[model samples]
Target chain A: DVKVTQSSRYLVKRTGEKVFLECVQDMDHENMFWYRQDPGLGLRLIYFSYDVKMKEKGDIPEGYSVSREKKERFSLILESASTNQTSMYLCASRTGGIVNTEAFFGQGTRLTVV
Target chain B: AQSVTQLDSQVPVFEEAPVELRCNYSSSVSVYLFWYVQYPNQGLQLLLKYLSGSTLVKGINGFEAEFNKSQTSFHLRKPSVHISDTAEYFCAVTPSGNTPLVFGKGTRLSVIA
Candidate 1:
């Protein structure tokens, strides 16, 4: 089965601290995405990468950034963590191109900024 | 750009009863629709997707959804539900060949004994 692995399942960071959440997919998928899931809001995409070294901002990309240095690895970064940034982060990957396909998701990382 | 709207925020029903979760979308172009379920404190799982062809799509765990092009809606349904069916269901859409999928606010299903 295809596997998407997230680096952490739960994390706590102090305000103003830089934080990183990592993800890796073994399916060799070319597209990787980072989304923040909150109660009532569901899942909101923060950023998505169609290829290595290429990224695009999603609707709610205000306080988050992402990096895809390698094909299998995509990383989400919080330059300065804040209380409002506390939420469950999810990583997903899908095949390349615009073909209709469902994304495989990780177990998710729940972050709390204190 | 594409947007999805889940008409109901929460639906409660007794076990063995039929249920339907309504979803609608607005987009200028043709799109792909999907229904995902997220159990408590877990990642989202694909329940079903409607890309093309038949409007009635059957998914895992005895769930199915119908894609109505005229109404621009994809509603998930099940003839009979179980206690294990309790989860948050999200409706998503992306313009055919789009990057990110736009998601709805989600509908929480509560199964009563």
Candidate 2:
């Protein structure tokens, strides 16, 4: 089974603090994504990386940045965490072959910005 | 740009009852549709996907979805739902080859006993 692991299952940070959420995939997939899950909004894409050192902004990328220094790891960074940024963050990876490729997700990290 | 719409935000059904979660999409090119389920405090899992061929696609946990190209809809259904089936379901769409997926708001399924 493809495994995508997140650095933390839950995190709490004070306002204006910097926060980082890490994700690693063992399948060697070329595409990685970061998303935030909210009650009514569902899952909104924050950022995505197609290759090492490459990144693309998704629908809602404000206040968030991503890093893809290596193929297997993707990191989501919150420059200044705020209460509005508290959400369940998810990471997913998929192969480069086709767009229909199934993405494997990691157990999300629930971040609480106080 | 591709976009998805999940009409129902919440669906409540009795255990062993049939259920359907409606989803619609707008895309310029041929699209690939997918239904994903996310349990409480967990990640989203692929329930089913409709790439091509047979319009009906069956997935894990006895969940299935039908792809209607003409209607631009891909609705997920289950003959009989269980209590364990309670979760948030999301419908997503993407263009044929190599593109990012556009997800709908999601439908929350609450199975009552």
Best by lDDT: 1
Candidate 1 stretches greater than 4 Å from native: none
Task: Supply the DockQ value of model 1.
Answer: 0.71
Docking class of 2: medium
Model 2 per-residue lDDT tens digits across residues A1-114: 789999999999999999999999999889999999888997889999889999999989999999999999999999999999989999999887664577789999999999
Clash pairs detected, candidate 2: none
The local distance difference test score of model 1 is 0.92
Model 2, B7-65: lDDT tens digits are 99999999999999999999888888889999988898999888889999999999998
TM-score on alpha carbons, each prediction = 0.98, 0.97
> After superposing candidate 2, which stretches have Cα over 4 Å from the reference?
none
Mind sharing the TM-score for model 2? 0.97
